[model samples]
Each structure stands twice: as structure tokens, then as C-alpha cells.
Target: MSLIDELVALHGVFAAGEYSYRGDRFSYKGHVSEEHARMASIMCRATSMGVHMQADIMAGSYPECGVAPAGGWVVRGPQFTVCVMANVFCFLDNQASLNAVMSILRTRLADASSDLI
Candidate 1:
């Protein structure tokens, strides 16, 4: 089966707001919104991995604001962990060049689609 197929199989699992897949597990962190849940479902479906799909609630910007980081060991409290954040798109240019580049990068890097909102 395709990776997306595998991920979609877990729609119920992710929509429930917290689940584990492949090896990465994600918790929704707060009250789950439909937008977050749907986006999370699509990401996992495309990547066959779980992801944290919560809002960026840190002083107007969230660390890891851009595309889900390429898997790395992030030590928050001395424990190394693999984390992914939803990719951010900056529509700064009138031609939308920045967003376009990011969209391509996301597709190439994570095998995920652009989260155009």
C-alpha cells in the first residue's frame, strides 16, 4: 500500500487528537480543532508518521515555525526527541515566490503537500 494509504487508514486514530504511528507519536496538546485534526491526518497520511498539529502559541511565533524539521534529536529537558512542526508559508512577495519555494520544498522534503490556508 502507498504511504498515504497507510496514513489515511489512521484517520480515526489521528482525529482522536493523539496517536502513534511508524515510530513517532504526537499528542494534540490542547483542545483539538477540526482544522488541526484534518491537517494532521493529511500529513501523517502522506508521511506515514504522526505529527504534532497544535497552534503556534509562543510570543507571536512558534519555534520550528516552518516545515516540519527533518528528523533530529531535540533536547528539551535533556531527553533527545524527534519532532516535526507544520510548515509555515510567508506570502511576503506579491508574486508569492516565497510560498511557492516552500511548497516545493515541503513536497520534496517530507513528501507532504502545502498547507495553504
Candidate 2:
């Protein structure tokens, strides 16, 4: 199965996807609709860019602060949590699944480019 498929199949993961840095391309599987996936891609790209920008500013202002080279981000909600690594996004129902999903994403997508442009 594909990586997104594999992630969606994992326990507590209801949806998973991959999006381009530009937010123009994406693919997803599981309970999400196509339109939702597209919007998610755009949101993910914007959020990732925002994080990178914050990290850049932090690194420049505080050299000792190791916020540069952002690894990923997470949005925890009452019902679900969205975990993003590289360009991949996973919507998990339980926080318990975060570690496993992040481990897989970090290993498999280690080479993924995070360039903003």
C-alpha cells in the first residue's frame, strides 16, 4: 500500500495526505473528501511556511535557540490532532498514535524537500 494509505490504516488515524510546498498538488486517502483534502493542502502549506518563517526569525534573533530547520508541527484538538512532517499530514483520533505516525513519517520522508519556494 501507499504511504498515505498505510498511515490511514494505522490505529486512530482517520485521514492522511501529502501536499506540495506550493499547495498546488496533493493526494489523500481515508475519510476526507477531495475538496477537504485540497483545502487541507493549502492550509498545511501555509502553516508550514509560517512555522519556518518563525523558526528563521528565532534563529536570527537568538543564535543559541535551536529553532531553525523545523522538523514538523502538530495541532491538537479535542477530537483529533493533525500532525505534519515534511509535506505529509496525518489526522489522528487519539494522541497515542502521534509517536508511531511521526516515526514512520520521519523515516520514510526524511529526504522530502521543505523548500518554501
Candidate 3:
């Protein structure tokens, strides 16, 4: 199965998608609409950029902080959470799903370049 399909098939995952650094939606699966997915891509790209910037700053200042080369990020809310790795995004319902989803994403996208800015 495709990565998107695999993620959506996981329990508690309601949506999954992939995008470019330019915020272009590549593909998506599950419950979100096309419009929302596009918007989500933009948001994810922007947030990832910000995260990398912060990591860079931390690395430069601390040198041994181990914050550089960020792998991914997560935004948690009371009822939902958004997990992002490389250019892939997944919407999950709980913390348990978050761990499973991130593990899969980190392993599957291990070689995905994070230098796209």
C-alpha cells in the first residue's frame, strides 16, 4: 500500500497527506476535503520552516543542544493532533496513535531530505 494509504489505515488516523516544500499538495487520503488538505499543506510547510529556523538558532547557540536537523513536529489539541514528518502529515485522535504514526513516518521517511526550503 501507498504511504498515505498505510497511514490512513492505522487506527485513529482520520487523514493523511503529502506535500512539497512549496506547499503544493502531492496526494492525500481519508476524511479531509481537497480544500482543507491544500490549506493544511501550506500550514505544514510554514510551520516546518519555522521549526527548522529555531533548530538552527539553537544549534548555533548551544552547539551541543542536539536540536538541529529536526525530523518532524506535532501539534496537539484537546480532541485531535497533527503529526508531520518530512512532507507527510497525519491527523490523529489520541496520544497512542501519535506514537504509532510518528514511528512509521520516521522509519519510512528516514531518508527524506529536510533541506527543502
C-alpha lDDT of all candidate models, in order: 0.33, 0.84, 0.86
Better of 1 and 2 by TM-score: 2
On lDDT, the stronger of 2 and 3 is 3
Give the poorly placed runs of model 1, Cα more than 4 Å off. Answer: 1-30, 49-117
lDDT of 3 by residue, 5-56 (tens): 9999999998899888876446788898988888888888889889988998
Clashes within 3 Å, all models in order: 1, 0, 0
Candidate 1 backbone collisions, by pair: 67-87
Sorted by TM-score (best first), the order is 3, 2, 1
Q: Pick the candidate with the highest lDDT.
A: 3
lDDT of 1 at 77: 22
User: Which residue runs of candidate 3 sit more than 4 Å off their true CA positions?
Assistant: none
TM-score of 1: 0.20
Per-residue lDDT of 3-108 in model 2, one digit per residue for the tens? 8988988998988998877667898987888999888888888899889889889988998897677778999889889989888898889655788998988888
Against the hidden true structure, what lDDT does model 1 obtain? 0.33
Top-down lDDT ranking:
3, 2, 1
